[model samples]
Target: MLEPIGQATAAAQNIWGDATQWGVGTGVGTVSGGFEFPSVEEIDAVLSSWRARQASIAQRGNTLELMVSSLTQQPAEDDATTGYIATWAQSLTQLRDQHRSMLEYIEDYIKKLEAAKQAKQAGEAENEAAVQKTAGDLAQ
Candidate 1:
């Protein structure tokens, strides 16, 4: 639901990156400011919420399918109304699949971002430790 807002925020960050390349001679250049980076926990929570949404969608789809089946069995007289309901049989399923795919992609990306952030932090820590050891060795 609110995933599109998050995506738009990410898009803005990327757009800000482009400004750095064009502004050496120019007087006033765009500065990086006011960017809110979401924590891993926030991302995880969002992913979980989306998963729950997916489950609800699946369950609802199943229920709707059953209802539609019952309607078809009864054989309605109105072709126009029946035809519209029939279209939903395909549309609803497609909507579910598309939503699932999108959520999966977002969850995967968030997980990967978390992994990369952890790896970077670990590497920085190792470097600091190595520098401290070198300084201690020199002091002795």
Candidate 2:
């Protein structure tokens, strides 16, 4: 009977590797350096930072939404000052909606990065196992 070897495919996107320092920026678990493939740790760190930022931005969006909700209840008087405040509220609403959309993008990208890492790590392990099995079978 052939025994199944372990696979590390789940660790494919672990880009941070053994590096002591990570670069500054939002990395989506992909090799942004082009010249060098990032370690899983590096990618994970970036994702974590991005998620934290997203949460913060989401809270800001909620606050903006609340401001819009409250300000919209007031009647826009004919005076320029009142109209300007109303316009500001409307702009805040637009900004909040945009932030929501941006959050979706960040979430989707993070998922992709995780999957990629897994596939890569697993694939490599799978190949190595196959090679070892073949050699063992030949020796048997």
Candidate 3:
């Protein structure tokens, strides 16, 4: 009975080891199948697309900031002379609120992008460390 149990355990271990090996092989094959270096033209196209998007966002934000600043800086037109002054005041308030909201959104987006970039960098570092460890083990 003990001998049979030992054989079963060994069989189970062998099955588990084989499964692990196959899983690793499948993962490597999948990654290699998908991996390709982008041509310089493709790289430039992607970079230009991103740069244009960045520039557009920056220009919009700057325009909003400038409008808000200009509105806030101007002296109030005398209310007694014209109710246009009151209307201007109300419009200025709305503009300020919109600008503030947009600025907040831009700030949040920047922070999120930074966090994602940092996470990618950290993951690459971890992968490098793992590769180095495997290389050292193989050397020994």
lDDT of 3 by residue, 1-140 (tens): 22435777779866664333332222222445422222334445554565566667667767766655654544555666356655666776687677667656766655544444454456567889999999999999
- Leading candidate by lDDT: 2
Question: How much does candidate 3 score in TM-score?
Answer: 0.45
| CA lDDT, candidate 2, residue 79 | 82
Model 3 residue 30 distance off true place after TM-score fit, in angstroms = 25
Clashes per model (N, Cα, C within 3 A): 0, 15, 0
For model 2, residues 1-140, the per-residue Cα lDDT tens digits are: 22333444324325434233534443334465322225656667776887898788778877777777777565656688687886887788788778888989988977866775675567668878999999999999
TM-score of each: 0.50, 0.58, 0.45
The segments of candidate 1 whose C-alpha lies over 4 angstroms from its true place after superposition are 1-77
- Candidate that would win on TM-score: 2
Runs with alpha carbons beyond 4 Å of true place in candidate 3: 1-81
- Candidate 1 lDDT at 128 equals 90
- Overlapping backbone residue pairs in candidate 3 total 0
